[model samples]
Target chain A: MAILEVKNLSIEFGGLKAVEDFNLSLEKGELIAIIGPNGAGKTTIFNMLTGIYPPSNGTIHLDGENLLGRKPFQFAQAGIARTFQNIRLFSNASVIDNVKMANTADSNENFFESILRTPGMVEKERQLDEHALELLSLFGLEGQADTIAKNLPYGAQRRLEIVRALMLNPKVLLLDEPVAGMITTELDEMAQLVKELREKHGQTIILIEHHMNFVMPIVDRIIVLNFGKTISEGTPAEIQKDPRVIEAYLGGGFHGNA
Target chain B: MKNKLNSILPPVVLVLIYFLIQLLLSKKILNPYHIQILMFACVNIMLTVSLNIVNGFTGQFCIGHAGFMSLGAYGSAIITTMLFGGMKMDPNLRIPVFLLSLLVGGILAAIVGFLIGLPTLKIKGDYLAIVTLAFGEIVRSTLRLIEPIGAARGMIGIPKITNLAWMFFFVMITLYITRNFVYSRYGRASIAIRDNEIAADAMGINTTRYKVIAFVFAAFIAGVAGGLYAHLMTFIQPDSFSFVKSNELLVYLYAGGSGSITGSVLGALVLTIIPEALRFLGNLTNWRIVIYAVILVLIMLYKPSGLFGGKEISFLRINRDSFRKPFNKFNDPKLADKQNS
Candidate 1:
C-alpha cells in the first residue's frame, strides 16, 4: 500500500483553477521529483498537502488516514512536513531554537512541570537540547547554535530550513525548490546532501525543483507538470526522451500547421 | 544531586534578596519617598512584563492590558469589602485570604482575556490592536455604568494590604514565571508564531493555542498587578485604566526593550522614577513628561529593538554555564556564524 495517496485533488480560486485532477500514489521511502515551469501548480500541491490550502475536491490519505479536514499543525503531527520555496526560519530566534521549535508540540511537559523544575522534565529538556544539537552538528550548525537565524549566511539558512523540517519527525518530507538560487558548487553540495538524507535515513522525500541539474541526478522518478496538470511521469531517462516534456520546456515548432 | 541544589538555588536567592530589601527597610536606610517609588516601579514592572508576553513574546499588539488590570482590581476589592461585608477577620488568616482573593481577581481578568483572544484568531496585527483598544474603552465605560462598583465616582476605603514586601515577592514571581515561560516549549511555540505564523504552523505548533495562552497568561499577570495596585492606592477609578494608561505601559515596555525581562524591569523602574526625578526641576515640572517622551523617542530611534533587544541576564537562565566564557569573547556566536556558515 502507498504511504501517501492523492486522488482527484483540485483547488479553485474563484473562477480560475489553480490545480486540477492531481493524483499520486507514493510508496514509503520513495523519492519523486515534481518539475514544471513557473506556474505548473507544483507548489500548490505542496500547499494543499501541508494543509495551507484545503483541496476543493477529492481525498488525501497519509498511510490510510484521511487528511482533508486536518489543520496545518495537524498535518505535521500526522507526519507530513514541508520546507518553503523561500527559506522561512524563525529569523529573530537563535538557530537552535528554530530547529527545537519543530519538536515543541511533542514535548509533553506542562507549564507547572517546567516551572517547578521537576527532575523528569529537566531530563526531557536536556534530551531535546541533545537532539537539536545532534541535528545541528550533522549540518555543521553546532558552533552557530546560539546565533540569530536571520544573520546566518544564505546557504546555512537554507540548510537550517531542511534541518528544521527533519526535526518534525516527518514520514513524508516535502522540499519545494530546495535549490532555488545557488552557485553551481553550492547547488551540487545541497543536492548531494539531500540524496544522502534518503540513502542514510531512508527519508521519504517529494522534491520540487526548477534546476534540472539539481533534480535529474537525485530523483528516482520524474513527474512533469504544465498548466496545473501532469504532462508526463516516468523514470528520468524516459522524461528526458518524452516529446511532450520537451514541448513543455521549449515550445514545439508549428511549420506543418502554418 | 547537584541538579536538586541548582533547582532550589533560585528561590533561595530570591528569599535572600527579599530579606535584604526588608533589612534596608527596617534599618531606615531608604526614605519613605524612595520606598514608595520602588513599590510603584514594582507594579509597573508587573504591568510591563505582563504586556510584554502579548506584545513582545507572542508578537501581538495588545492595548487593553489596563482593562484586565481594572477587572482584577475591582474583582479583589469587591471580594474583600463587599463579599466580606466589612467583617473583621482573624489577623493570622487575613494574608492568605487576601492573596487568594488576588488570585481570584487574576483568574477573572484571564477569563476576559480568553474571550478577547477568541476573536483574535480571525483578526491580526493592526486590527487586533484596534480590537484591544476598543476592549479597554468598553471596560472603562462598563465600569462607569455599573453603580455597585462606585461607577464614575471611583471606589474608596478598600484595605491597603499591599506593602513593599508583597510587591517585591509578586514582582519576582512575575519575573520568574515570565522568564520561564519564554524559555519553555510552549513559550518557544509562541515565539515561533511571532517569527512566522505559517512556518510555525507547518512545524506542528498550534499558532492560535500558543497565542491565546500568551494573551491569557499576560492578562492574568496584569490582573494580579491590578490587585496590587488597588491595595497600594486604596482606591481605583475607571479613568485610571484608560487607553492612555495602556500607552504609558507600552512606553515602559518599549523604552526598556520588549522581549527581555531585564528590559521590562529597567523600563518600568527607570520610567517610573523619571517623572518624580523631574520634580527636582521645580519650575520645569511639566518638562518631566517631555523628558520621558524624549527618552522614548531616543530609544526608538537609536535602538529600535530596545536596549537589551532579545538578550537577557546571564544568571536568569537555567544553565549557569551558558555564560561562563564571557571574558575571552573568542568564539562570539553572533559574529562567527556568518563567517563559518
Candidate 2:
C-alpha cells in the first residue's frame, strides 16, 4: 500500500481554480519532484497535502488513514512535514531552538511539571536538546546552533528550515524549493543531502523545484505541472522526452543531459 | 551539591533581602511612604512581568491586562471584605485566607483570560489590540453596573493586609514561574509562534493553543497582582483598573524590554520609583510626569530594545551553559572559516 495517497485534489480561489484534480500515490521511501514554472500551482498542491488549505474536492490518506479537513498542525502530527518555498524559519530564535520548537508534539510535560521543573521534565528536555543537536550536526549546523537563525547565510537558512521540518520525524517530507537560491556548491550539497535522507533513513520525499539539473539527478520520479494540471509523470529520463512537458515548460530549444 | 545550591540560594537571598528591608523600617531609614512605594513597585513588577509573557515573550499585543488585574482585585476583595468582613478571625488564619482569596482572584482572572483569548487570539496584530482594548472597556463598564461590589461609587474599607513579606513572596513566585515557563517547551512553543506563526504551525505547534496559554497565564499573574494591589490601597474603585492602568503596564513592558523578564522587572521598579522620588520637589512634582515622559522617550529613542535589550541578567538566566556556549562559538573566526570551506 502507498504511504500517502491523494486523489482528485482541487482548490479554488474565487472563480479561478488554483489546482485541479491533482492525484498522487507515494510509496514508502519513494522520492518524487514536482517541477513547474512560477504560478503553475505546484505549491498549491503542497498546501492541500499539508492541510494548510482545505481542498474543494479531494481525498488524502496518510498510511491508509483519511486526512481530509484536518488543521496544518494536525497534518504535521499525522506525519507529513514540509519546508516552505520562501524559507519560513523562526528567524529570531537560536538555530537549536528553531529545531526544538518542532518537538512540541513529542514533549509530554504538563503545566505543573514545566512550572516546577521536575526531574522527569528536566530529563526529557535534556534528551530533546541532545537530539536536536544531533540533527543540527547532521546538517552541519551544530556550530551555528546558538546563532540567531536570521544571521545565517541564505543556504544555511534553507538547510535550517529542512532541519526544523525533519524534527517532526514525518513519514512524508515535503521540500518546497529547498535549493531555490543556492549557488552551484550549495545546490550540489543539498542534492547530496536529500539523496542521503532517502537512501539511509528511508524518508519518503516530495519536492517542488524549477531547477531541472538539481531535480533530475536526485528525484526518482518527476511530475511536471502546467496551469495547475499535470503535464507529465515518469522517471527523469522519460520526463525529459515528453513533448508536452518540453513545449509547456522546457521549450523547444532546451536539451537535457538526462 | 551544585544543583542543590542553585535551588536553595535564591530563597535564602530573598529572605535576607526581606529582613534587611525590615531592619530599614525598624531603624526609620525607610518611612511608610517608602514602604508604600516599594509595595506598589512589587505589584507593578508582577503586572509588568505577567504582561510580558503575552506581550513580550509571546509577541501578542494585550492592552487589557488591567482588566484581568481588576477582576483579581475585586474577586479577592469581595472574599475578604464581604464574606469575612465582620468576623474577628485569628491573624494566623487570616494569612491563609488572604492567600486563598488571592488564588481565587487569580483563577477568576485566568478564566476570563481564557474566554477572551479563545475567540480573539486567532486575529493578529492591530485587530487583537483593538479587541483587547474593547474587552478592557467591557470589564470596567460591567463592573460599574454591579451593585454588590460598590457599583459605580467604588468599594471602601477593604483591609490593608498586604505586607512586605507577602509582596516579596508573590513577586518571587511570579518571577520564578515566568522564568520557568520561558525556558520550558511551552515557552519555546510560544516564542516560535511569536517568531513566525506559519512556520510554527508547520512545525506542529498549535499556535492558537500556545497563544491562549500565554494569555491565560499572564492574566492569572496580573489577577494576583491586582489582589495584592487592592489589599495595599485599602480602597477599591472600578476607575483604578481603567485603560490607563493597562497602558502603564504596556509602557513598563516596552520600556524594560518586551522580550526580557529582567527588562520587565527593572522597567516596572524604576518607573514606579521615579515618580515617588520626584515628590521631594513638592511644587515641581506635577511636572515630574513630564520628566518621566522625557525619560521614556529618551529610552525609546536611544535603546529601543529597552535597557536590557531582550537580554536577562545573569541571576535571572536559565540554561547557563547554553547561554555562554552560543555567543562564543557563533563569533569564532575558525567556525566561520570552517563553514565557508
Candidate 3:
C-alpha cells in the first residue's frame, strides 16, 4: 500500500496554473525520483505537498489520512518533512543547533523547566545533544558541528540540511534538488547517502532532481513531468526509453507544455 | 572542569560587588546622585534584556516596548494607589497590596503582547514595525484621555515600594530566565524562525507559536520593569513611557549585539553609564544624545551584527596537547550511505 498518495492535485496562481491535475503515490520505503526541466513545477509540487502553499484543488493523503489544508508545520507534525532547493541553514547558529531545532517538538523541555535547570532539563539537553551529534556524524560532520553552519563547504552545508530534516523523524522525506550545485564527486556522495537513507532508515523519499545522471542509480521508480503535469511514471529503465519524455525534453526542457 | 567554574565566577563577583557598593552607598561612600544613577542602571538592564527576546532572538521589530512598560507601570501603580495609598480606607494594606498589583500589571501587559502578536504575525517587512509603533501611540493617547488617572497631569503620591533588593532580584530572575530560554530548544526554534521561517516551519516547528511566545514573554518582563519604575520613581505619567524610551531600549539591544545574553547585560550596563559619564561635557549636555547617536551608527556601519554579534566569544584556547585525540571516531563517508540512501 502507498504511504503517500496525491490525486488530481492542481494549484493556480491568479490566471496561471502552476500545476494541473498532478497525481502520484509512493509505497512504504520506496525511493522515487522526479525528473523535470526548470519550471516543470517540480518545486511547486514539493511546496504544495509540504503545505507551504495550499493546492487550488485535489487531495493529499498520507497514511490513509487527508492532508489538505494543513499548515506546513502541521504537515511536518503529521510526518512529512523536506529540505529546501536553496540552502536555508540558520547562518549564525552552530551546525548542531540547526538540526537540533527539528527535534524540538519531540523534546520535553519547556520554558519553565529550562529556566529552573531541573535535573530533567539537563538530561533532556544531553539526550538532544547526543542525538544531534550522531546525526552530524552520520553526515561526516561531527567535527563541523561546533562550527557555524555558514562556514562549512558547500557540499557539507547541503548534507547538514538533510540531517536537520531527519531531526523531525519524518515518515517521508522530500529532497528538492539535493545535489543541485555540487561537483560530480559530491553528487556521487549524495546519491549514495540518499540510497542509504532508504535502505537503513526505512524512509520513503521523493527526490526532485534536474541532474538525471545523479538519479539513475538511486531511484527505484521515475516520474517525468513537463509544464506542471506528469507526463509519465514508470521504472527507471522504462522512463529512460519513453518516447513522449524525449519529445517533452526536446520541446522544452522540464519547463515545456504538458 | 574549568568550564563550570568559569560560568559561576562572574555572577558571584557581580553579586559581591553589588552589595559592596550598596553598603558603601548606605555609609555615604558614594554620593546620593551616584547611588541614584546605579539604581537606574539596574532598571535599564531589565528593559534591554526583555526587549532582546522580541527584537533580537525572535527577529521581530518591536518599537512599542515602552508602551508595554508604561501599561505595566500604570497598571501596578493604579492598583497600589487605589488599594493602599492612604487616600484609600486602608493604609495598612500598602506593601503587600503593591506587590500583588505589580504581578497583575505584568499579566495585563502579557495579554497585550498576545493581542498585538496575533494580528501582526501575518504582517512583516516594515508593516509589523508600524503596527507596533502605532500601538505605542495608541496607548499613550488613551492614557492621556483618562481623567481618573489625572490624564495629562500624571499620577502622584504613589508610595515608593521597589528598592535595591526587589530591583536586583527581578533583574537576576529576568537575566536567568532569559539566558536559560536562549540556550533551550524553544529558544533555538525562535532564532531559527527568525533566520528562515519557511525552513523552520518545514522542520515541524510551529513558527507562529514560537514567535508569539517570545513576544509575550518579552512583554511580561518589560511589564515587570515598568512596575519597578513606577514604584521607584513614586510617580507616573503618559509621557514617561514614550517613543524615546522605546528607542533607548533599542539602542541598548543593538549596542549589546542581538546574538547572546551576555551582550544584553553588558550593553545595558555600558549604555546606562555613558550619559552620566559624559555629564562632564558641561554645556554640551545636548551633545550627549549626539555622541550616543554617532556611536550607535558607527557600530552599525562597521559591524552590522553588533558588539558581541550573538554568542559568548570564549577567548580561552584549547591546549595543543588536547588535540591529540581525533574529534569523532564515528564519522565516516560510509555512514552517509547507511543513513541517506
Candidate 4:
C-alpha cells in the first residue's frame, strides 16, 4: 500500500490554474524529485502537500486517512514535514532552540506543569536538550549550538533547516529547493547528506529542485513539471532522454551525462 | 543538595529584600513618599514584564495593554468597593478579600484578552497594531458610558488596602511566573512564533493557540497590576488607563530591552525613579524633562536594542551554563579536527 496518495490535486489562484490534476502514489522509503523551471508551481505543489495552501480541488491521503481541509500545523502533526524554499530559521534563537522548537508537538507538559517546574517537566526538558544536541551533531552543528541561527554561514543555515524539519519525525519529508544558493562544495555535501538521510534513516522523501546534477544523482525517480502540468515521469535515464522534457527544459544544448 | 539550593536561592533573596525594605520603612528612613514610589515601580515592573510576553517574546505588536489593566482595575474595584464595601471586616479578612478581588480582576481581563486575540491575531504587523490601538480607545470610550462604576466622573472612596508587602509579593509572583514561562517548552513556542510565525506553524506549533495564550496571559498580569494600582490610589478612573498609559508601558518595555525579563524590571524601575529623582532640581525641575528626553535619546542612539539587548542577567537565567559550554566545545582543537575530517 502506498504511504501517501494524492488524487487529482489542483489549485487555482484567481482563475489561473497554478497546479492542475497533479497525482502521485508514493510508497514507503521511496525518494522522488520534482524538477521544474521557475514559476512552474513547484513550491505551490509543496505548499498544497503540506497544507499551507488548500487545493482548489483534490484529495490527499496519508496512510489511508484523508487530509483535506486541515491546517498546516495539522498536516505537520499528521506526519508531513517540510523545509521552505527560502531558508526560514528562527534567526534570533540559538541553533539548539531552532531544532527544539520543532518538537513542541511532542512535549506532554501542560502550562501548569511547565510554569511550576514539576519533576516530570524538568526530566522532559533535560531529555529534549540531549535529543536536540544529538541531531545537531549529526549535521556537525553541535559545536555551534549556542550561536544565533542567522549568524551561521549560509550552508550551515541550510543544513540547520533540514535538521529542524527532521526533528518532526515526519512520515514523508518534503524539501523545497534545499540547495538553491549552495556553492559546488556545499551542493555536493548536501547531496551526500540527503542520500545518507534516506539510506540510514529510511526516510521517504520528495524534493523540488532546479539543479539537474544534484537531482540526477540523488533521486530514484524524477517527475518533470512545466506550465503547471506533468511533462514527464520516469527514472533518471528515461527522464534524460524524453524529447518533450528536453525541448521544454533541458533544451537542444543538453547532453545526457548520467 | 546543590540543585535544591539553586531552586530555593531566588525566593530566599527576595524575602530578605522585602524584610529590609520593611525595616527601612519602620525606621522612617524610607518615608511614605518613598514607599509610594517603590510600590509604583513594582506595579510598573509587573506591567512591563507581562507586556514583554506578548510584544517581546511572542513578537506581537500590542499597544493596548493599558486596556486590560483598566478592566482589571474596574473589575477589582467593583468587587472590593461595590460588593463588599459596607462591611467592617477584620483586618486579616481584608487581606484575603483583596487577594480574591485581584484574582477576579485578572481572570476577567484574561477572558477579554482571549476574546480579542482570537480574531485580531490573524492579521499581521501594522494592521494588528492599529487594531490594538483602536481597541484601547474603544475600551476607554466604553468605560466612560457605564453608569454603575461612576461613569465618566470616576469611582472614588475605594479602601487603600495595597501595602508594600502585597506589592512585593505580587512582583515576585509576576517575575517568577514570567521567568518560568520564558524557559518552558510553551515559552519556546512563543519565541518561535515571534522569530518566524510561518516556520513555527510548519513545525507543528498551533500558532493561533499560542498567540492567544500569550495574549491572555499578558492580559491577566496586566489586570492584576491594575487591581494593585486602583487599590493603591484608592480610586478608579478610565483616564488612568488611556492610550498614553499604554504607550508608557511600551516605552518601559522597549527602553529597558523588550525580550529580557531583567531588562523589563530595570526599565520600569529606572524610568519611574528618574522623573521623581529630578524633583530635587527645584525651580530647575522644568529642565528635568529635558534631561529625561536626552537620556532616552542617548540610549536609543547608542544602544538601540535597549540596556541588556536581549540578554538576561545571570540571576534570572534558568540555563546559564548551556550557552557557555557550546562555545568552549567549539573552540576545542579536537572537535575542530574531527569536523574537518
DockQ of each: 0.50, 0.54, 0.51, 0.55
- Compute each candidate's TM-score over C-alphas: 0.92, 0.94, 0.91, 0.93
Compute the lDDT of residue B259 as modeled in candidate 3. 56
Residue-wise C-alpha lDDT for candidate 2, range B1-341, written one tens digit per residue: 44456667888898999899889989999988898999999999999999999988888898988999999999999999865678777777887888899999999999999999999898766677888899999999999999988888888988889998889999999988898899888899999998899888888899999999999999999999999999999898999999999999999989999899999999999999998788888888889999999999999999999988669865566652432334544666565455344
Q: Once superposed on the true structure, which residue ranges of model 2 sit more than 4 Å away at CA?
A: A255-258, B1-8, B320-341
The C-alpha lDDT values of all candidates are 0.85, 0.89, 0.82, 0.88
Write down the worst ten-residue block by lDDT for model 2 chain B.
B320-329
lDDT of 3 by residue, B1-341 (tens): 45556557656766887789778888988876876677777888888988888888888899989999998999999988777654545556666787788888888899998999987866656666888899988999999999999898889977788877777778878877887787787788888988888888898888878888888888888888898899888889999888988988888888888856667777888888888878889999889978977878898899777787776644111111122123233545454334333
lDDT order of candidates, top first: 2, 4, 1, 3
Q: In CAPRI terms, where does candidate 3 land?
A: medium
Evaluation by lDDT, superior candidate among 1 and 3: 1
For candidate 2, the TM-score is 0.94
Worst 10 residues of 4 chain A by lDDT: A249-258
For candidate 1, give the lDDT of residue A244.
97
Position A207, candidate 2: lDDT: 93
DockQ-best of 2 and 4: 4
lDDT of 3 by residue, A218-246 (tens): 89998888988889989877876788987
What is the per-residue lDDT of model 1 for residues B1-341, given as tens digits with 9 covering 90 to 100? 44456546767886897778778878998667877888888999999999998888888898878999999998888887764456767778778878988998999999999999987755656777888999999999999989988999999988888988899889878887887788788778988988898899999998888888888899999999999998888889999999989999998898888888788888999999988878988888888888878988898999998987777875455552332233323555653445345
Off by over 4 Å in 1: A250-258, B1-29, B83-85, B318-341
